[model samples]
Target: MYKIAVIGLGYVGLPLAHAFASKYEVVGFDIAEWRIEELRKGIDRTLELSEAQVNEAIANKMLFTNKLEEISTRQQLNPKKRISDNVYHSYQIFFEYKESYYPNSNKPNNQ
Candidate 1:
């Protein structure tokens, strides 16, 4: 079983994580504790996914967390294997320029 870690559970990352959860073990990591709690409660405030979709991902055994340590443990599961051995996707790069897009907001650019 392949384990996938998605290091941003925003619009792009959340949907991507849910899609991957259907076929692989998925760990959806976000910096926001609120976001983690929302997902765990089957809520997707971003609206990229419906509550049912979030629940389905949970039912599929997807893990959502706000802790980097949790993701680190998953990556370290196969220490001998390189990072490429597992599926790792990160949408955080887009967040770097979020300020420019939002022009004062810290939220990600959904458009």
Candidate 2:
């Protein structure tokens, strides 16, 4: 079976990961070690997926990690195949901040 890697276990990513994990083996990767630990304990601070959902995914053998290298450990199982071949899908979310959104209302002179 192919694997899917969902990077970012935050609001958007966690729900997507849990949904796909229902049918495929998923590797949920995050840069935050605390986030990974929370996930392992079936706690989702984002409140996207319930604790039951988290536990269900773990019971299905879904792997959660904070280490970047851990995401590729599965691909090592099939060195004969391309890394892309082992990973059937990858999903990620990125947020960009705009200074305009938060105008400098607190500027020393303005304040």
Among these predicted structures, which one has the highest TM-score? Answer: 1
lDDT for 15 in candidate 2 is 90
lDDT of 1 by residue, 72-98 (tens): 555466566655423433334454466
Model 2: lDDT of residue 59: 90
Off by over 4 Å in 2: 73-111
Each model's lDDT: 0.78, 0.74
Show pairs that collide, candidate 1.
none
TM-score for each model: 0.66, 0.64
Which runs of model 1 end up more than 4 angstroms from their true locations? 74-111
> Model 2, residue 16: displacement in angstroms?
0.7
Q: What 10-residue stretch in candidate 2 is worst by lDDT?
A: 90-99
